[model samples]
Target: MNHAQIRAFHAVASEGSFTKAADVLNVTQPTLSGQVAALEEIYGVKLFERRGRGIEITEIGRRLHAVTLRQFAVELEAEQVLLSARGLMSGQLRVAADAPYHVVPLLATFSRLYPGINFSMSFGNSQQVLQGLFERKSDVVVMPNIHEDRRLHAAPLKREPLIVFVDRNHPWAARRSISITELPHHRIILREKGSVTRKIFETALESAGVKLTDILEIGSREAVREAVASGLGIGVVFESEFGNDTRLHGLTVRDVQLEGLEYVACLKDQKNSPVIRAFFDQIQSSTATNLS
Candidate 1:
């Protein structure tokens, strides 16, 4: 009946447990349970089936939860509108990035300009980044090599050449560059599937007819870097991203024409959101000023 009771029920239904739902709502477990109980009693409908420690939402609960999702989303949008009208003095901006390399610097610049705005970041592969945007889990996404998607608007920020890297102890460490055909001779460590960098590099290799014999697939960029630095294998990454790690040496693939174009993107509907707009504006200003 009331927003408090609705919020309690929604949280409980979404989280599937009164304890966890109470934690999410920042209220005591008993208080949260009381609120939900009152709502169900008033409506004369059982929203959830209580097991010993677990809870299951009934069909009616699921329907009500779906409606509450839209209702709360609109409520949040209203709050953001008010915050935007107040010159963006305070608001939360959630961003998802494929890697910190492209997003951290940009967020740092935005924070410097609007210190009051709270920013949070999540990292995943490019596919996950896009999925976050679609699921409304993130306000924006930073990635590279993203193709055109009508549901989103992507702005290219920078292009970085794909390059090879190896540990100092590796025989190829002393070399400034290597040929694409020579890849099979060295152990190749690649990022897992859905990684844009891995896709680009692999596409280039396939086009060049270079089939790597020894391949290791790692899930994270940090892992790939550590593996290569430990002389486990040769790693490929964007030149701009592979910072000056003294333990590893970067080498250009002489005949490969692969590059990653970093981009900042958001759902097309939210492209004009105050937080998203501000971030894009900062990118433009920074690009014009060559701040990086």
Candidate 2:
């Protein structure tokens, strides 16, 4: 098949809609449709089954799409290899992260080291970050919680302790530390269900036999910080991430200790990629010095 026809077919098969595929390819809908039609006519085979506004991939289409996926991946690797051999300083790196606090600093450091490298970052919860890595949408991910996935290579960044913060005007503001059992008696504001911070905090509470009763769920860390500063409820976060917010008071939990581990990760097969390796090396060196 001709390149244009194959591209149109692949786009359509991936997107499931001609209109969306055309958008992805930056081509007019008619032109995309014509290319795909030409391919099918030349081959004397039906690649897709049309339904009202959507299309379903036929058996042959599915087979072709599988081939295209592998083909595109290999093509991308070939491009990277050529770029490396040419000693090119410029390329794009897409990174996904569960939190900006863990990612932005490392990215800033990388940018300074390789000024020509462009970075595009997307933020989500831990689950979404992991999903992006698995789907090959991102070159690397910065995450707090990692599972035992043999397909991934993870490097430790830092371990941060989870602490509590409250409004400056709240009763607990004067206290330097509080026991874990005292948590259930107060209104606690925490990150939403998917948060690794929330997961670690909850696990610690469970281990201490202190159940969380009065709780308010906030979706973002900034929102949680602001709500706590407004005297809504106490907030839980990594001590290093709490920063120096003047309106809030950060308190240590004396009886319970919870630490969240940060990691820089890439697919095991891609660990040796030039760009990924450079970034990973910096993280390893930086964390090692901090630990020492």
Candidate 2 local lDDT, 1-292, one digit each (tens)? 5988998997787667898778777899999999998999999989999888778899999999888767666765886688778664987789999878879999998999888888899998888789778666889999886877876999888878889999999988899999999988999998888899889999998898888789999999899999998889999998778999899999888887688888889876577567887788788768976444
Off by over 4 Å in 1: 1-85, 287-292
Off by over 4 Å in 2: 1-81
TM-score of each: 0.71, 0.73
Per residue, candidate 1 scores C-alpha lDDT tens digits across 1-292 of 5999999997787666887778777899999999999999999999999988788899999899889877776775786688777888887799999889878988898999889899999999999888777666889898887788866788878877899999999888778998999989878999999999889998998999989999999999999999998889999888877998999999898897988778888876566667778888888855543324
The lDDT values for all models are: 0.85, 0.85
Compared with the true structure, model 1 gives a TM-score of 0.71
lDDT of 1: 0.85
